[model samples]
Target: MTGERARVIVVGAGIAGVACARELAAAGVPVQIRERARVVGGRMASKRFDGRPADIGAAYFTVSDPDFARVVEGWRAAGLAREWTDTFVAYGADGRRAVPGPMRWAAPGGLRSLVTELAAGLPVTVDRLVLGVEPGPSVDGTPCEAVVLAMPGPQAALLLDPALADATRAVQAQQWTSTLSAVLRFPHRRWPDFAGAFVNDHPVLTVLCDDGDRRGDGEPVLVAHTTAEFAGRHLLQPTAAAAGVEEAVRDLIALPEPADHVHVHRWTYAKPAAGLPEAYHLDDDGVGLAGDAFGEPRVQTAWLSGRDLGRALARRLTA
Candidate 1:
């Protein structure tokens, strides 16, 4: 790492962090990204089962903001992303009904690929966990022009020093929820033909996705996301929740054969309970915070939050 490089350190390699770094790099801000995970893509995670990848994080992403749309278009052009569906089945007291909305996008290689593509040519260090963010607006002991915490507020709060009153207060004010994603690989596709469904008002499951349909591969795999309440009960032993999750999925769709394989992933801070009006929080102390908590908890929102924060940081540093 050169002295001139990494003037700004953006923690968390999720879409938000990567998006922030992209903006800073575009503005020639010399930014560096540090991801504690082995790979990037925070919540937009994918795990492989029997050599086939299944989305275990964000089920799908939508495009709305003109800026985010353009970003999605680039991914589309590069064959990294594709339009998945515009409708989803909702299961509630009234029974199942098709809910039409914006077109949700998916990646053949999994959503994580999209982030990887976006972070191309940028300096990203994986498996490099940051211990602390201190008074000098520094990462661990390394000083930087600015520091962006592009993750869940709770996670950011852990790294913040109490002395950084403004940033600390901003993060502590945020509340988040947990979730568990279970991937069920079936021997064959016997479930409904829907691409995805909103398991509304369910105690166990909240969302279900046809992994085969979304990946455009037509495989007999399904991914189910558990409600925060259910996940909270199984956070300690996430794998122990797999059987219960699979049973609930089978009961919901009434499948004949059980899932041949099941894998579970836990998200302690899966989503924010509410969002602030601001796009991001950038304190005069040169400490910045960005994530979906700034708005609706969605992939686009997280990206926009980071993009806005990066621009703000760039302007401040440049000025």
Candidate 2:
């Protein structure tokens, strides 16, 4: 570790944190990112399953905000993102219905690659798990001018100190849903031809996506997410949780049991019940907060929240 570097420590290397650091760096403000994971891209993570990459976190993002659209355009031109689909099949009491909406965008190398691209030149210290914040607004006791908790509201609530009681109260009031994801690997693709399936009214399966198709590789892998209710019942025993999720996916899609074993990952804070209107929030202590939970819960909202916070912190630090 260098004795002298950026005085700002941004925790959580997810899309929001990385986007914040990128904007701060671009504004000529020194910033350092600390991520608990071995690599950046927190929720937008992609892992190799059975030899191929699978998106186990966020499936895809929607672009609508003009500013976010501008950023997406840059990523698209750089070959980081491609349009996945503008339609999805929703399964419910009325049976399957095609729902047309905004064009959902995906990345060629998995969604995580897009976050990595955003963090290109920023200084990030990975594998540094932060526990809590101190009165100095330090992240686990590393003194810094400011600290940015760019993660889920529930996770961030745990790190906030009493010094920011107001922020803590607000964050604690936020409720988040959890989901269990199973990566089912198959020798050959055998599911119906759809971009992704929204398993409505299903007790176990909530969403299922063809990983190969999402990545635009035509590889045979499926990622299925369990309903929050189902996940809450089995989050502790995630491995055992995979059994039900895999079975539900198979039954819903009318596919045979996966030839290979299914891989499971749990998201304790999958989505927020409500979002704040503000882009970024800060307190008198120089501690700040930003993420999808603070604004609209989506990839673009997360990025925008981070960008706004980074710029605000830059001004405060430089003042």
Q: TM-scores, in order shown?
A: 0.98, 0.95
Best by lDDT: 1
* Predicted candidate 1 versus true structure: per-residue lDDT over 166-260, tens digit per residue: 99999988999999999899999998779999998899999999989999999998999999999999999999999999999999988999889
lDDT string for model 2 (219-300, tens) is 8788888889999998898988767877788878788656477888989998887888778888877788888987678998
lDDT of 2: 0.85
Per-candidate local distance difference test: 0.92, 0.85
* Candidate 2 local lDDT, residue 262: 87
List candidate 1 stretches off by more than 4 Å: 1-3
Candidate 2, superposed: residue stretches over 4 Å from native: 1-3
